[model samples]
Target: MDNQVRVAVADDHPVIRMGIEATLDDISFIDRIGSVADSTQLVALLDTQPCDVLVTDYAMPGGQYGDGMELIAFVRHRYPDLRIVVLTSMEKLALIRGLMTHGINAVLSKADDMSHLRAAIQATRTGRRYYSPRIANLLKALPATGSARLSQRESEVIALYVGGDSINTIAEKLQRSKQTISTQKVTAMRKLGIETDADLFKYAIELGLTRKKPLSD
Candidate 1:
């Protein structure tokens, strides 16, 4: 077993937190020194006893770009030595590119295998960079889909929609009525030649809106 490496985890869902912690428990190299649900708490903890590596959710409560970007910016400005790897259900290449431009140490999908996550964490901790195969493949494939145009709002709604969030939940989160969210989703789907939620979800994965969810019982 490797020496315990100070680690921090941030995710919105309790189940996700549990899963991450459980995985780390199996790896002696990870100590899981801290955990938080949102960006605010994550930032606060870092200000006091920042861990060797920060694993954060891509998006968080309140719409202030509280995603990994905010925390990444803080680390860049205040704690330049800190390393960060964004673990997210989001597949958007835009967010990945944004993180890269902001000095994020690495980006990994929650859907990736545990080996990939471990490798990324270890690599980033040593000042090396690692982007998962999904991210690298997405970046390479982004240019091929030039004809599909989706507005920013559509993109946001679709991401939530594909990430297993109900339409009502998305509407509530976006501060819009269910009808509006439904209409926009239908319009976006039609424009994209999507017929079912499965198709919509597939397009989202293809467009890098959300990472593919693991199939498990």
Candidate 2:
């Protein structure tokens, strides 16, 4: 396929990688070059087999290189020419905004259908930005937090805490220190004017921070 849009995908879940491959296969202009499980492998693949577009999960575990913002930063720094389309389960407005600053061409939530992914890829190929409808709505609905906006990490910590995960659990899940998680929790609470756990949970629910939909949906 001459002038085909070469694509590489990185996702820890085999089912997700297969699904993305299958989705891209339906597009005649897209060529599936490589599919890997972690950010380290994705970087290695990109070094050897460069692609025009990279579709990756934001929170892929089991890699020497960290996932989420760190992985996105690494890709943006090392592969500046490679267009990135993030297909993630994370719908946090702060996180999406952070990814946008890191040169991500598109952001699509896993809750959305494959049509959004297709649109993102096509738009990215033309040097345009695309956000899934769900993500777009979430971004639009982000409420201001006090005098300063919440950072992505702060929002993540708050979301996990509000979802009933303890500070220790959130620390472990995010690969951060307990103190760091606690500090973020405190900072987030202060910013959102949440004085108690009940208030925080209610606010998180109101903002749709909890992951209600199954990943397979």
Candidate 3:
């Protein structure tokens, strides 16, 4: 195999994918093998031109609206050489764990770190597991099992908010808007049966979502 790595990027949003392309453009060794919007184009590209690595977004339309997992599974079985990395905003460990269980090469979130994206692609090319720093730290801090486990996205929001960052800060970090973050926080609180800031902070720690240090003298 050559030293230069071939990469295929699949995402529904044009702006983000364009940003990703620009980011990869700086890397001398990465060859932009293919770039496609939506899952249909990806399927067509995979059928005609195979890429060394497949970087895609979860919860996107492939077979239909929000059926990315099916396509991934199909690719895993049909094309064994295709190294798959789920590059998306979905931070739920459940979704990450599910995709990884199906033999994905790597699972990365758009929020925690972008530097890891390049590293993950390289790692997957060599047939190894590539979990981002946030994921590795998450696993180190939180267990996946038990009802205490919160979705990765939920934890992300809680971590920022509980850590004293405002909604706008969280928004900028996650590449989302303040309204979206506000709405999600309220929704997640309801789902977790929390009603106040104190309760939410307590829940975040109990779920191993954040590390809120106790006040010291």
Candidate of highest TM-score: 2
Predictions ranked by TM-score, top down? 2, 3, 1
Alpha-carbon shift of residue 16 in model 2 (angstroms): 1.2
lDDT, candidate 3, at 131: 83
lDDT of 3 by residue, 1-217 (tens): 6777778888878887887788777788888878888777787887788578888877567444234566777777767778888876755544554465578758877775566778888888778888887666554554233224446887678778877778988999999989989987876665554568787765455334456685433
The whole-model lDDT of each prediction reads: 0.72, 0.80, 0.71
Superposed model 1: Cα runs more than 4 Å off: 1-3, 63-65, 142-217
Off by over 4 Å in 2: 143-217
Scored by lDDT, the top model is 2
Clashing pairs in 3: 91-152, 92-152
Worst 10 residues of 1 by lDDT: 139-148
* TM-scores of the candidates in the order shown: 0.60, 0.66, 0.62
Of 2 and 3, which scores higher on TM-score? 2
The TM-score measured for candidate 1 stands at 0.60
Instruction: Give candidate 1's whole-model lDDT.
Output: 0.72
Ranking by lDDT: 2, 1, 3
Pick by lDDT: 1 or 2, better one:
2
